[model samples]
Target: MVRIDLKEKEAGTGTDLDSVLAKQRAAFNAHTNPPWSERKANLQKLGKAIEEHAEEFQKAISEDFGNRAYEETTIAELLVIKGGISHALKHTKHWMRARRAPTALQYKPASNRIIPQPLGVIGIISPWNYPLQLAVMPLIGALGAGNRAMIKPSEYTPRLSDLLKRVLGTIFTEDEVYVATGGVKVASAFSALPFDHMIFTGSTSVGKIVAAAAAKNLVPCTLELGGKSPTIIDESANMDTAVARIANGKLLNAGQTCVAPDYVLMPAEKINSFSDAIIEKAESFYPTFAGNKDYTSIIADSHYARLQDLLEDAENKGARIRVAGDDDKQQLAKERRVPLTVVTETTPDMKIMQEEIFGPLLPVVASETLEDSMQYVQSHERPLALYWFGEDKSKREKVLTETISGGVSINETAWHVVQEDIPFGGVGPSGMGAYHGEHGFETFSHMKGVFTQSRFSQGKNLFPPYTDKTRKMLGLMKKIL
Candidate 1:
């Protein structure tokens, strides 16, 4: 049996999360199922708010990260969110419509339909990396499904979180969509709330804690956690193209992305060439690391220290380190940027190989054959995303079938996430549940199966106490079925 472990007050917020939840719940109860027009208006308002506050958000996020690229903020956060809102606005009516389900022959003339209904208040726990996107993407789904929501943005990105709270507050009522800002204590309390549903995006370790807290209230959760997402450069892959694409994905956000290529697996023969090409590619992308506005800084001091520690551990474990771009202490002091470092000669025991390298460090592992590459990925926890670059259709098909991941991109990286039509999520420890576009609507809405019995329905035949006639009827029905 699940238990409720909520506290009277959340330490970080210094407010009663219980009362806040009660307010949202009360509002939702008063207006149970909002009409399509109202939901559409809400979505429109949200999109407008995001557009109006885009610069503010960019500034606040940059402050949070020391030196985030403005274009990265625009492209990765604002544009992606607006696109999602546009997609939701265009298709939400259709998504909300009752889906026709075929009735069985025994229940002929009876109509079956699956109705999607709001799940009341949803709680969102978003991470620091891509704070705006992770927090609002799920909120988009919840709103599209006509559900109210409360968001808890990461404390690490306090400025962005505060900005989000203020911006959202201007457009939405507290009871409609509340942004709760605080540290770990507030996050802990927020996760323990008895929400209708919850969505969390962060590391696997923290995801487990949030899942456990939500489970205490028996609230279903969508966990968008991270793992060692792999990139495989098949023998048939064009080294130049693969190298360029991987470097683009891996270096974007300074490799702080959850779905960034954690490591690379390639055939032994191509290791040296691939390494040289990627280093050159990284250098070309950011001519110099120091004072380069195009390059993003790591989020915090601890994170920067953590990346250095990972490198140190790997090097001590006999892994070779190749640094690309200048390593300037001035840049580190000002922006917290770490130049792209590629590690080779990695073993399974090395911390860099074992842990999710959520920084600008890439470990290139050599595999003797495609089977060896496949075996390496399969042996580890299924990743959130996988990239396989090759022109060979047969090899691509083989990788697609034989390997598993939350999502896949062929001949590219991270682009699969922006495709609004498909579901995006992880398979195992990487995460659970998918939400994007229509999938997002379904995740936040409960699909209730409804059957309207016809006046002449035969469903009653199996409802009463069994008799000889009923038994005969059941047998006949079974034969027909």
Candidate 2:
């Protein structure tokens, strides 16, 4: 069961949104501007808190996800969060440093520089899939960029949210980092609030709603939405290595990851071998997923049902279902457990082929040629991530250069998201804007341009005198310099 703690209500109404916003507004007004050193200190302290609670954070995620592997959680959530913080700490000083710019000829004796400043208070709505990492990492960015924050963690992972609230309470005052916990109603209220900036991580459908609500206030937002990400296995790829990497990535968090390989595209002749290899590798990783403790988890009962429904629908439409583990109904139905399912001979009209299967289901489509596979991906919405496995450098470069995705990986899956140096985000339907490393700090910051000039009159001759001499002088200046 999930436990919630809401602030006491006022007479004749629920908790007051006006009061909460007042507190935030007051805080923002008091600290209208802050120095770079203070922002760096706060960010460093937050990073220390995260490191101190690393074990607790990992355990909370494990409990929430039922059978989440400790190592996987550490790699996927903990390490990613740590890496984001560490990267921010290392480069924030440089990121915050004012950048000098050339003064325009019209503005003589003036010096210009771009200063990255905070956007006051930022609101973050994190999804349940990666509650700990997603929630805290963005906050790190906001704080690093010198902004106050309010976070709304998904109610689906209520336990983790409670833990986060407690942890944050120890390290920060409510004015520094506040947490609001409730169901969808609270989420709606939170999104509707006029935050200086907002960051949302969830499905594209829900993202649309958040975007629409944010539009009311003309609030800037960084949305990280999900889509049907594709993995292409070229003919020159190492079959064994490709299969292992795909299986490892797909089964992590039971495929509840945003960047997990949603579907695979390969030559028609290699489909059978690839499918067999994936099943073999999956069994090797978890001898019995129903009883195996190494494999991670599913979100909840409803999600399990939804995954089953998608599979059933595909099966009813003549798609072949291949199970990597035991297919016993009783075992599968236990709690939120579902075996890794591989679908083949899929048509474009099938629901599974068209939708993002946020479960341990892998869809394999055979294409007549590499171009056919590329065309399939091109036809769909731009994905948050894309993957390719092949030995031919030329072919790999061609795929990478030709395609447009939020991020890409070569010969592996889901590893690009962990590269702290590169920016992580989506484009078009997948998502908008990015946040991680310097990109993250910039997202939460406003680059204000400042110009300083000496009070010297150097262009007195060009003061509104519409003569041929003046025009000729202006033309000469423009052409020469």
Q: What CA root-mean-square deviation does each model show from the true structure?
A: 4.0, 2.6
TM-score of candidate 1 versus the correct structure, residues matched by position:
0.96
Per-prediction TM-score to the true structure, in the order listed: 0.96, 0.94
* Model 2 clashing-pair count: 0
Candidate 1 at 286: error in angstroms? 0.5
- Model 1 steric clash total: 0
What global local distance difference test value does model 1 have?
Answer: 0.89
In model 1, the runs with Cα more than 4 Å from the true position are 1-15, 329-334, 463-465
Candidate 1 structure quality by residue, lDDT tens digits, 186-208: 88888999999999999999999
Model 2 poorest 10 in a row by lDDT? 5-14
Candidate 1 Cα deviation (angstroms), residue 261: 0.5
* Alpha-carbon deviation at 424 in model 2, angstroms: 0.8
